[model samples]
Target: MSHDRRRALARHDKDGADRDSGGDSGPDRVEERFLRPFAVAAGDPDGSGPGPGPETLDLLTLVVAARTPGRSEWLRPEREAILRHALRARTVVELAAEVNLPVGQVRAIAGRMIEDGSLQRCGPSRPLARKDILHAVLVGLRSL
Candidate 1:
């Protein structure tokens, strides 16, 4: 975390710590109301520049943890919460709901997680078409 982000989180943490005992307490888990619009994104906390690779993420895509996050670098609270829920395969949309963050913000975070190799994306499973089913059976009867 940057100095500014650490200060912001500390200020928010101090303000929030006394009043909200039920909520999780952490730098990354700062309540949405306390965060500036751009601060909600994990990659670019200061929001001075755009973060990388949000292009690959969509709400329907599923993500799962590739491995445990690194203690030194990956300890941000928002990401930790996201990883906890993603221990099982889940869609980006589901992660958003579980984390209590907006879908767009969650998408950005998930995109970074995928980029960093902390999370892996799963392609959406679709039902096979009738023609696809027939194609599989027809291969056994083909004539030379």
Candidate 2:
């Protein structure tokens, strides 16, 4: 395994031990659960490479969170937290920082939320040029 992967696995194991020994509290336990799969995937004990890369989610993309629509439930509390945080307009980076998760993971989670329609991208509604604004002003003056 790569050095970084080994380090991550060690940290994960340490965190797991802490949980088992009751050294960690609520949020820490939640974080550990969220990170465990990433650690295992990184470790790749079978000598396989990392899993397929997640789709790119732009850090600047603005997302607005909403309820999952119907009875569909979130599988992970961490993801639900992410959705909750995104209830207001927030960039992927901001959500990541707020939730203390890696940006890539945040991106993946946001992408999934978007796919499930629990989040909506608040993209630029329109791009108005200075020329367009000036032209509109001139047209209004002519009409008046």
Candidate 3:
């Protein structure tokens, strides 16, 4: 990767880490840490920029949604929009704005998702969430 690309992605990763430490404390940032590097390496195949391949983006999106703050519901268009666009959403307020929803509603959903196995808490201070499905796979491997 070009130095400029590396730097940009590093910046993105740093930003992601910051978001991981914020509210909602859900699944988004955990997945970003692993996938963003791959996305950067893949480059904009269409010559657009640092975006990853469509498959990768979709995988990461699913992982992000699965790990989302609550419900583990099907990927709603609004939630997908937030993941596709916003990179620094820690609170329901930020997520609501990203997905154009009422903060109360988002908060409820986030809480539900976290309660379900769809998301796992990272730490008390850190607001990171790991997609349970993906995490299960990792756990399975670690056991082997």
Candidate 4:
């Protein structure tokens, strides 16, 4: 709020002058650094400064655009194999062993699949029990 500082700023603004006005003034130095092209450009690539590359943000936006709610998409190979063994095996532990993955990883993937409507428990939530309807149908067919 000094009279000199206020007058200088008013002069610069009224003249529509670039902040880099031909002098080593304090405001000019500050504006030179802050108004540099790289400072203001979003998604500066080359890792030369802050923020992500344009390509990275663009790819993320594309993925978000592609996602749909409610119905789950078809599985990747790893997800399919994990779901298969989870349904066939007696326990999460058993499924993990069958798939040769850590139990925690198996459980996390299975939980996501179920939440996303891609997989469901065939019977009661407990493992080791054969699905009753499937078992009875198989038994009666064997008699035939």
Judging by TM-score against the true structure, name the best candidate.
1
Task: Say which candidate scores most in lDDT.
Answer: 1
Model 4: per-residue Cα lDDT over 16-93, one tens digit each: 244335445646555556432322122112223432222211111111111222223243444556555544324556
RMSD of each: 18.3, 16.8, 18.0, 23.7
Candidate achieving higher lDDT, 3 or 4: 4
Candidate 2 C-alpha lDDT tens digits along 50-124: 445544578888888876433343345556677778878898899989988877767876766676577788865
Write candidate 1's Cα lDDT for 12-126 as tens digits: 7675444344444543455555733536655545343563445567778889988765573354777888888899899999999998888777887788878778899976477
41 in model 1: Cα distance from truth in Å? Answer: 3.5
lDDT per residue as tens, model 3, 47-85: 334233232121112223334333322344443444443
After aligning candidate 4 to the native by TM-score, how far in Å is the CA of 29 from where it should be?
54
**Stretches of model 1 off by over 4 angstroms after superposition:** 1-37, 43-48, 72-75, 124-127, 130-144
Against the reference, the lDDT scores of all candidates come to: 0.72, 0.67, 0.42, 0.44
Model 3 regions lying over 4 Å from their true place: 1-75, 78-89, 120-144
Give all TM-scores, in the order shown: 0.54, 0.47, 0.29, 0.32
Query: For residue 119, what is the lDDT in candidate 2?
Result: 78
* lDDT of candidate 2 at residue 99, scale 0 to 100: 80
Residue 10 in candidate 4, Cα distance off native in Å? 76
Alpha-carbon shift of residue 56 in model 1 (angstroms): 2.9
